[model samples]
Target: MNAPSSLALAVPALSLKDIGKHFDGLEALRGISLDVAKGEIVALLGTSGCGKSTLLNIVSGLLPADRGELRIDGQPAASFRDWRRIAYMFQEDRLLPWRSIRANVAFGLEAERSRRAERIVKAEQALRLVELDGFARAWPHQLSGGMRSRVALARSLVVEPQILLMDEPFSKLDPQTRAQMHQELLRLQRFKNITVVFVTHDVEEAVVLADRVVVLEPRPGRIRAIKPLDLPRPRIPTDLAVSEQVRQLRMAL
Candidate 1:
C-alpha cells in the first residue's frame, strides 16, 4: 500500500488535516483528519455527538472548522471556487411538497440561474438515472418511501456533482427499502464515478456501502480507527464475510 504522502501527490478529492470544531465551547471534533480519493466512497461512522455530521458540514462549506485545513481537489477550500461540484443530501428528503417531482429535481439548478429549458432537460436526465422518469409529474406525497428517496437522490444528482455528501439519507426507510437504496447509490456512484462521503450510525450500511469506514469516538470526537473494506460488491448482510465485518465494526463502535 502506498503511504499517505504518496497518495496526497495524486490529489485526493477531499482532504482535511487536524480538523476541529466547537459549539459554544463544547468541542464536537478534534484532530479529525481524512483523505477521500476521487471516486471513492467513505463513511463517517459514529454515534450521536461524535461529530460525524459536523465534519461533513465542514467539508460541505456549510460550517467552518474552528481549527484545521480543508482541501478540495488539491486546492485549499478557501480558495476553491467550484462550489457547484459538491452537493449535499440531508437526512430528510426535503422534497418540496408543493412541487412536482421534476420541479423538485430541478431545484438544485435554480441557484445556477440556468435556463428553465436546460434545467428541465437535466432534471429529466437525473430522474431517468434514478429510475424515476415516469414519476416526473408525481408529487412527493404520492410516492412510497423508497421512491421518495430516489427523488431525493435525483435532486442531488441533477447538479452533476463531483463530490456527494449525505447525512443518513436513508435512515428512515424499511430494511428492504434501505438495502435497495444502497444498491441504487452504489450503482449511481460507480456510473458517475462521483466521490461520496456520508455520515451513518449503521454498521451494516457502512460495511455495505463504504470503501473505507472512519470510526469516531465521542466527547470531543476523534478518530478511533480507519478500516478499509476490500470485500466483493453486493455484500449481503447474511454473508459470512460481510456479517463478520459488520460485527467487527459494531464492536468497534
Candidate 2:
C-alpha cells in the first residue's frame, strides 16, 4: 500500500489558498489553505460550527468562496464546473426515498445525459464495486444502516469522480458498522485511487481513515495544524503507536 505522503501516478487533486467565507457580518472561515494530493485521503477535524462543511461546499463548487483561490487538477475553480470530477457523500444517505438503490446510484449520471440503459449498467457496476450488487433492487428503508451507507458510497462512486468529499458520512452508524465503513472506505479509496477530503469531529475516525488529519480551530475556522499519519494502512486504533497518534491528534485539536 502507498504511504500517506508518497507520490503516486496521480498528480495534485485540489488546492486552496487563503480561502474564506462570510455571511452578512459573520465570518465562517478565514485564510484556510491546503492542498490535497491526488489519491490522498485527508480528514478535516473540527468541532461543530467550525466551517468544515462550508469549506467542503466551496471545494465542491456548491458555494463560492468569499476570498482566496482554488484549483482543481491544475484548472482554475472559477472557470471549472465539471462536477462529475468531484463527488460528495453526506452525513445522511440522502437517497431519494422513492427511488430504488440502483436508481439512486445512477442519479448523478443523468446530469451527464446518460441513457437510461447506460445509467443502469454503470449503477449496477458501481453497486458491485461496493459489494451491494445484491441489494441494488432494494429500497433504502429495506436495508441495514451499513447497507444504505454502502449504497450512498456507490452512488458517489458511480460517476467515477477524481475526488470524493465526505462530510461525516458514517457518523450516524453504530461502532461496528462504522468500523466496517472504515474498511470499506479504505478498500474503495485504494481501488478507485480517488482523492478524499473527509470532515469529522471524531479523532479516531480521522486518524484511522486519512493519510493526513487537518485540524481546524473553531469559531471563524482556521487550520490549527496538519498532522500526517506515518502509520501503516488499515490503521489499528488499539495499537500503542496508533493510540499515541490519536492522542496527539486530540491534543492538536
Candidate 3:
C-alpha cells in the first residue's frame, strides 16, 4: 500500500482549491478546499442541498466549478491525460437494460474487441470481488437492490481507476443490507488500496467507513470540520466505542 507522506501539505491523490459553483445566480458551493490522500477513504458529510453532490460532480467533471481548481495526484483536471484514472459510482446504478452484467461491467472496453476478452475476465473478477460472480448473465431487473448497488460498484472497479468518487451509493438500502455492504466495501478497499471520496448524508455511515470525515455546511456550502477516526480496522459497527464515537461525531457536526 502507498503511504501518505509525513508533510501535512503534501500533494494529495485528489485536491480541490478554492472551488465554487453556482446555478441560476444561486451559489451552491463557496470556496471549498480539500485534499484526499491515496488509499484514504474520506467521507463528505452534510445535510440535503449542502452542495456535497455538486462538489462530487465537479471532481468527476460532470459539473464545472465556477471558480478554483481540481487536481488528481498534483495534476490539474484538464491534465488528467487518461480518462481511466477516475471512476464514478452515482446514486443510481444506471445500468443499460439491454446489457448483461458482464457486458455492463466491460462496457468501457467495447471498442477493443481483442481487449474485450481480457476485459470480460477482469469484469468477472470484479464481480467476484463484490460477491456477485454468478449474476454475470443476469439482467439488471433480476437483481435485488443490494445486488444492483454491487453491480454499480463492480462497473466502477472494472476500470481500476486510481480515484473513486461515490455519491450516496448505499443510501437507499435497508439498514441490514447497508451494514453488510459497508463490510464488503471495507474488504474491497483493503484488497485494492483504492482512494475513495464518499459522499453521504448518514453521519453514522460516514463515521463507520471513513478514515476521516469532513462536515460541510449548507447554503453556499463550505467545510465546517474534519474529524479523524483512528479506530482499528475490521471494526464491528455495533462496538460500543464505535457507537459512542459516531454519536459524538454527529453531535459535533
Query: Of the candidates shown, which would achieve the greatest TM-score relative to the real structure?
Result: 1
Candidate 3 residue-wise lDDT, 1-253, digit = tens: 2465677536688989999999999999998988888889999999998899999999988788999999988889886776566788888888888999888888855644557669889999989989899999999889998998888888888888788889998988899888888898888888888889999998889878999998999998989988888887666668888888888877877
Q: Estimate each model's TM-score.
A: 0.96, 0.95, 0.92
- The segments of candidate 3 whose C-alpha lies over 4 angstroms from its true place after superposition are 1-10, 111-114
**1 or 2, which is superior by TM-score?**
1
User: What lDDT would each prediction earn against the true structure?
Assistant: 0.93, 0.90, 0.86
* Clash number by candidate, in order: 0, 0, 0
Ranking by TM-score: 1, 2, 3
Predicted structure 2, TM vs. truth: 0.95
Q: What TM-score does candidate 1 get on C-alpha atoms?
A: 0.96
Q: Which residue pairs clash in candidate 3?
A: none
Provide the lDDT at 2 for model 3: 42
The digit string of per-residue lDDT tens for model 1 on 85-168 reads 799998989999999999999999999867999999999999999998999999999999999999999999988899999999
Q: State which candidate has the highest lDDT.
A: 1
Show model 2 residue runs off by greater than 4 Å.
1-11
lDDT of 2 by residue, 63-178 (tens): 99999999998788977777777999999888898999999999979888668998999999999998888888888899888999999999999889999999999999999999
